[model samples]
Target: MAPSDPVVDPISSRLDYDVGELRRAELAADPVAQLRRWLDDAGRAEVPEPNAMAVATVDADGRPRVRNVLLRNLDEAGLVFYSNRLSAKGQAIDANPVASALFSWLGLQRQARVDADVEVIDGDLADTYWANRPQGSQIASAASPQGEVVADRAELEALVERYERDAEGLDIPRPEHWVGYRLVPHTFEFWQGRRARLHDRFRYRLTGGSWEIDRLAP
Candidate 1:
């Protein structure tokens, strides 16, 4: 017998939000600075997991996948996150070097979207970040076999216990399979929601190795 084909959903109703009130006047001169300001505001607003972002990547077949990952670092170079090289996300990134990330701060009614080209960071940078992590996190990294299927919770607990005992009072080394990745942004969009569904939207696109900011239709 053959397997059944998957069902597809039809087009849904259109819902429009006019983004007009969010003007360039509300943004910083520099997009990076604007992003930082939003991040700071999110932190002050007590948003849970302010540093967390939805990372999206495509597979070889062009199917997109997304998952929530902690934003470990961000700068002019772009956003950074760490993961196991052998994990599903790592494999997807290796196959397709392009990715996108989205940051949503519901409390502030703001969201930032980024589309970028990605590359794995150097070992030295990964090591420095690894060293700063709490001992428990380091131990957890060693114990968790990301993207692998385990028998049950007991198997994971056993591995955690073993690593905890083995790493007792010793310097936890960064695992060879774990590393950081940097996403170089080619385009970034900032969205701010306002009353009556009129919002602000500004986009920055890379042009001639420089950023060109423009007001996009809301």
Candidate 2:
């Protein structure tokens, strides 16, 4: 085979997406409500981790960074996800308090994008979610430093064991670093895959305290 010939070429293997459509009449006046509807549908369709969203942030150097995080709460306020305040993504959020998140339900051939301002929330809300977590997860969250380098797996296990021993006689309190962030969206785009790459897209943008919906070309 020639050097230019690839061993596994994916350029010609694109799948035609025709799973759904987005119509103006069917859209919710509020984008958040529309998002909730789509989320509920994804759950009913048994899409694994239906609440997972890829959150994108910009580092201090202006490079874009993206990582998947589970959506814990969603309402008119915003979308919430919890993480360590000192993690890489967290630092990025601190440096640049705006973020964009994408939710992809490939099985349904649908995707949603959210661009928003980030705000941290702690106090009772964080505590409530922390309390609902499994004991092992609590220990892990309190033990291992997220996005930090460790000597090895043994070092991490040791930290977990230490936390376990410390919490034997009492509750494992939530760490100060572990907190939730809410993304107050300024714009949202909902995409539905259609035949022949002519996907349907609708964008809801906040303008003058009201949402202005527009159709986007795929």
Candidate 3:
């Protein structure tokens, strides 16, 4: 095939982001509030999985890993997400509590980065969230040994079936391994894409019980 032939050529892919500008005057004084504003914008724009974020953690072996996690709760205290304690991310967070989470609202050409130290939420809170989850998800989270090697799909289906049978007519209590963590961010950076790759970035730093915003070079 000729190099110029479109059939054999590399698939087309590129983005010339030209989203709305992010200015200090338009931003909320608090980073959390600013995040909420962007979230609202993302929702209005019909961005898929607006609350999904890429959580990054480093294992004991010094390898970096990133996975998508849903944002369950957000407050001044921290950003909350849940995971099974036996999962790779859970183990990594336990080993090194410091982590980073990134929210890429590519539909709006915006992103948010958070660098934080994490702590497990109270048992009561975890219970509350677990109780609200669908029965199937609860059973799956409780039954499956996350991150563990299994024989096959059949093994998992069997485990789920067994758990469902055992949980019949009874409340499936939240497993100890199924817990929530709140990431208390010390730094947050917000980015808005622009034409010609001249983007806008603003970072908020927590200091002396207050937040200070600093504009960063694109």
Q: Give me the candidate number with maximum lDDT.
A: 2
TM-score of each: 0.87, 0.95, 0.93
**Candidate 1, overall lDDT?**
0.86
lDDT of 1 by residue, 1-218 (tens): 99785464345533354433466767776677788888887898899999889999998788999999998888998889999978888889999998999999876778999999999999999999999999989998988999799999999989999999988989999999899999889899999876556677789888998788898766
Candidate number achieving the greatest TM-score relative to the actual structure: 2
lDDT of each: 0.86, 0.94, 0.92
| Candidate 2 Cα lDDT to native | 0.94
Pairs clashing within candidate 1: 22-200
**lDDT of residue 161 for candidate 1:** 94
Question: With candidate 1 superimposed using the best TM-score fit, by how many Å does residue 159's alpha carbon deviate from the native?
Answer: 0.9
The TM-score, computed over Cα atoms with residue i paired to residue i, of candidate 2 is 0.95
Off by over 4 Å in 1: 1-21
Q: Residues 24-44, candidate 2, lDDT per residue (tens digit)?
A: 999999999999999999999
lDDT of 3 by residue, 8-81 (tens): 44456557788688888988999999998888888899999999999999988888899999999999999999
Candidate 2: minimum summed lDDT over ten consecutive residues — where?
A: 1-10
Clashing pairs in 2: none
Residue 18 lDDT in candidate 2: 73
Work out candidate 3's RMSD over C-alphas. Answer: 2.4
